[model samples]
Target: MLAAGSGAVPPVVWVPVVAWCVAWQASLQHEVIHGHPTPSVSFNRWIAGPPLALWLSYDRYRATHLQHHVDERLTDPLDDPESFYVTERDWQAAGPVGRLVLWSLNTLVGRLVLGPPWTVVRFALSEARAVWRGDPTRRRDWIRHGVATALVAIVIDLGFGVPLWLYALAVVWPATSLMLLRSFAEHRLAADPAHRSAIVESSGPLAWLFLSNNLHALHHERPGLPWFVLPKIYRANRETVLERNGGYRLSGYAEVARRWLVTPRDHPRHPGRAS
Candidate 1:
C-alpha cells in the first residue's frame, strides 16, 4: 500500500491510508483504555502510545476518557470531559462568530469538516493555560507528550522520510475528522443518564472501525465487554438494550448524515442548566 509511482508514496494514497491507520489506532486506544485483551494497564498504554495522530497523548486521552465514563455525568458540559455541549454562559460569551461556528459543528457533516481543528486548538489552548497556571499534572502530561511526539516525528520523518507537515495535515487531520464522524451523535443531551447515549444499529465496516462503539449505549452500560463480543451480546438482548436507553437509536451513519447533514442536531448549550 505504501508503494507509489517513482518509488515515492504518492500523497493521494499515502494520506488516506495513514488517516485510516491513525483512526484505527484511535479505536485501538479506546479499546486499550477499556482494559481490553490484557490485564496490565501499563502494557496497554505502551502498546498504544505512539502519537499516531500527533496531537493527543495516550495517557491524557485515557485520563479524560475514563472521567467521561462516569455514566451519571454523561453529557453534562461541566462534568463530562468528553462532552461537546457548551454551558449557556460559555455559549453566550462566545459572540456571534463563535456561536455560528459552534452551531455549524452540531451538524454531522460540519462536525467532520470543522471539529478536528477546533478540538485540537481548544485542547491545546486549555493545556497551555493549565501549564501556565502551574498545574503539575498538565505540565507532566505535556512533557511526556513532547517526548513521545518527538519519537514519532523521528520515525515518520527521519526513519521513513515522510514530512512532518504532510503527516500533520494529511494524516492527523483526516484521522481526527473520521473520529468526529463516530462521535458526532454518540451522545445527546437528556435528563436521564441512560438516555443520553445512542445505539447505532449498524453492522457494517464503520461499526468495526469504531470497534463496536457504535453500539454506544451498550458499551456505556458494560464498559468491560470486549469489542468482538458486543454485537453478539446486543443481538441476544436487543430489546432490553433499546428499552433501557429509551429507544435512542440510529439506523446507521448514513442515516445520521441524511438527517443532520444540514440541520444542527441540538444547540451546543446544555438544556438542563441556565447561564
Candidate 2:
C-alpha cells in the first residue's frame, strides 16, 4: 500500500527508512549465509540474493568473507580484502587533498558523508577501466551484477516512477549510513587474528537491526552458528571472548560515537602485524 502522506514526507525520512529496511535485509542475507533460517544454503541464498548490496554479489562476498575469518592474516594489506589501510608507498604517493580525503574516511562522520560516494564512484570507474582493458574477472563480475542492476532500475523506474538517478541517491546514501554503523568499529587491525575484531558490548536496538552481528567476535569464531543463537553463545563465553579479543570492547554505538566521532582510532601507519 502506498503510504498516504509518504509523498509529502521529507526525503530524509523515506530515504533512511528504505535504507534501514534494505540494511536489515542484507543482515538477513548474512544470517542466511551463516546457515541460519535453514539448513539449505542454496535456499537461504535465494531469499537473500535480491538486494545486491553495494552492488556486490552475495556468493562472491560469502567466499571472500569466509577467507577473512582465517585469522592468520587478519588485515595484511594484500591478504585481507577488507583492509582500509594504505601502504606507506601509497601514502607517500597521495597528494595533499587525497591524503586529507583518506584521513576523513577513517572517522565516523567521514565514513557516512564521504565513504559511499568514494566507494561507488571508485568501483564504477575501476570497473569501466577494467572493461576497456578486457579483464575477464571484471567481465564475469559485472555480468552477474548486471542482472541485479537492471532489476533495481526497473523497480525504481516502474514501481516508484522515480528517475534512476534520484532513486540511487535516495537509496545509496542512507544505506551507506547503515553500513558505516555496522563496520565503524568492528575491527582495528590487531596483531592477532583472534584479537583483530572488536566487540560492541551492548548494541541493544541496533543488535536486532544488525541481526545480532554486533557479537562479531563470536560470528568470526563460529560463522555456522545461527543469528538467534549467537547471543546465547556469546553470553556463555563472554569472559573468555573478552580475554581473547585483548579487551577491545565498547559500551555501544553511543560510546563509540562519543569517543571516535571525529578522531582516528589508531595511526593509519600501524602495521596490522600478526601476533
Candidate 3:
C-alpha cells in the first residue's frame, strides 16, 4: 500500500508489483481451499479470508471450487459453478450483442481483458437474487465476508491511506485477470471426464503465480496434493498424466494466446443437452 500511495512511488513499477501481490494472495487462497500446509479448514480460511479481489467471498469460493472437483461434471455449465459454458436456454434468450460478447470471451485475450468484470457482475447479480429469495446461507456468507473485509478496509483505507480506486484498478483487476489467464482453457466439453481438463506445461514465475496449477489436469486428478508437490507428481508420471487427459496440452500461456487469442475455443452453449 505504501508503494502505491507514497508520493515518491512510481506507478509504472509499483502498480504491477501490487497486482502481483494480489495475484499471489489469490493463489494462496486456492492453496488454503485445497488443505495446504495445515489441515484445519477454519485456520486456513482465517489465514486467507481477506477479500483482496473485492468481488468474491472465501466461503463461496471454497464451497463452489470443491464442487468443481467433481470430475464427472467438469464442464457441465449448470452443474459446475466454475464452468463458463451457458445453458441452451440462456444462449437462446441472449440477443445478438450478448452472443457476440460471449463468443469473444471464449478467446484467450478476450478472457483476460473482459472476463474479470463479467464474472464479478454475474456473481453479484446471482448473489443479489439469492438474497432477495431469502437464502440464509447467502446472507450468512455475505455477513461473514463483510466482517472480514472490514479488517481489510481498515488496513488499506485507514491504515495505509490508499484510495479504493487505486487498489481496485491496480490490484483487484489485474489479479483477477491473471487468474483468468490460468482458467481461460482449463477445461472444455468432452465425453471422457479425464479429458475435460487441459494441461499447460509451464514453470518459473508464471507457474508460481498460479501455484503450479497450470498443470491443471494433474491438479484435478489429485486435488489433495499441495501446489509445491504438483511438479514432482507430474514428473513422476508425465506420460500417464498426459494420456489420461487425452492429450489436451499446451506449451504455455504463449501457446494458449497463439492458438486462441482471437479464435473462440468453443461455442458458448452447452452441446447435446436441453437448457
Worst 10 contiguous positions by lDDT, candidate 3: 1-10
Better of 2 and 3 by lDDT: 3
- TM-score: the better of candidates 1 and 2: 1
RMSD per model, one decimal: 1.7, 3.0, 1.3
lDDT of 2: 0.73
Q: Which parts of model 2 have CA positions greater than 4 angstroms off? A: 1-12, 52-54, 122-138, 270-275
Compared with the true structure, model 3 gives a TM-score of 0.96
lDDT of 2 by residue, 1-275 (tens): 03412366666667667777777877887787677798787788778867535465665556556767777776665566556666776666777898888888788888778878876665567557867899887678777778887897676667666566665677766676677678878877766778888778774878988888888887888888888888888889999999998888888888888887898765554353322
Comparison by lDDT, 1 against 2, better one: 1
The reply for model 1, stretches above 4 Å from the true place, is 1-7
Which residue runs does candidate 3 get wrong by more than 4 Å?
A: none
Candidate 3, 118-186: lDDT as tens digits: 988987887889889999998999998888777887788877778777878777888899988989989
RMSD of 3: 1.3
Error of 3 at 27 (Å): 1.3
